[model samples]
Target: MPCVKIDMIKGVRSPDEIKHLAEVVQEVFLDKFAAPNRDRYQVITQHEPYELIFEDTGLNIPRTEKLVFIQIFQQGRSADQKRALYASLAERLEKDCGVPGSDLVISCNRNEKEDWSFGYGRAQFLEGDL
Candidate 1:
């Protein structure tokens, strides 16, 4: 399972647009990361323009108010999986959400099954509830 956090500047997209964007990301996760159909866990946060900052990091890619920052936290995933995820996200986001590859930044973090607790003050993974 992966928990995704999508951050962007407020007012850049309408509410429907944001929902569609999240759905697009979820699709990528399902196709590339092998996430379960009901395993969707995502948070979309919109901040004021002044609350977000991004730089090209010397890649010379242009940054804009439409920038999207996505953080994916999950368990083991192979490097190839990550590569495909990145490529698919870029292409699909551009084609479906109008988010250019240059304006998208993604970071994936690794964790263990024990790190998640779905509910009830319990470690569901450890308890075999998941």
Candidate 2:
């Protein structure tokens, strides 16, 4: 399972645009990470310009108000798959949503399947509810 949190500057993207971005991210997971089609877990949070702050972080890549920070919590995947997923997201987001890949930031936190509790006060993956 992948639970995504997208942070962005408010008003930079419309509600529809955010939805499209989520779709693009999930598609990459499906294509490269073997994620199930039914596993769609995504959320977007908009912040006032003053609330979200960042710099080049030594990459020297300038950012703009359109910046999107995507954080994903999920089980482990191969490094190669992660690489492809990044590239694919960068490419697809820029092409489909008009947000340049340069404006995107992605980070992932990996955990065991036991870490997830889908519902009903149960650990679904571990308890076989999934």
Give the poorly placed runs of model 2, Cα more than 4 Å off.
none
TM-scores for all candidates: the values are: 0.98, 0.94
Computed on alpha carbons, the lDDT of every model, listed in order, comes to 0.95, 0.85
Per-residue C-alpha lDDT of model 2 across residues 7-122, encoded as one tens digit per residue: 99999888898888888888888997788889888888999999988787899888889899989887878888788888988898899888787798989889888887787889
What C-alpha RMSD separates each model from the true structure? 0.6, 1.1
Task: Spell out the clash pairs found in candidate 1.
Answer: none
The top-ranked prediction according to lDDT is: 1
**Candidate 2 has which clashing residue pairs, if any?**
none
Please provide, for model 1 over 1-130, each residue's C-alpha lDDT reduced to its tens digit, 9 standing for 90 to 100: 9999999999999999999999999999999999999999999999999888888889999988889999999898999999999999999999999998999999999999889989888999999888
lDDT of 1 at 41: 97
Task: Estimate the overall C-alpha local distance difference test score of candidate 1.
Answer: 0.95
Which candidate's TM-score is highest? Answer: 1
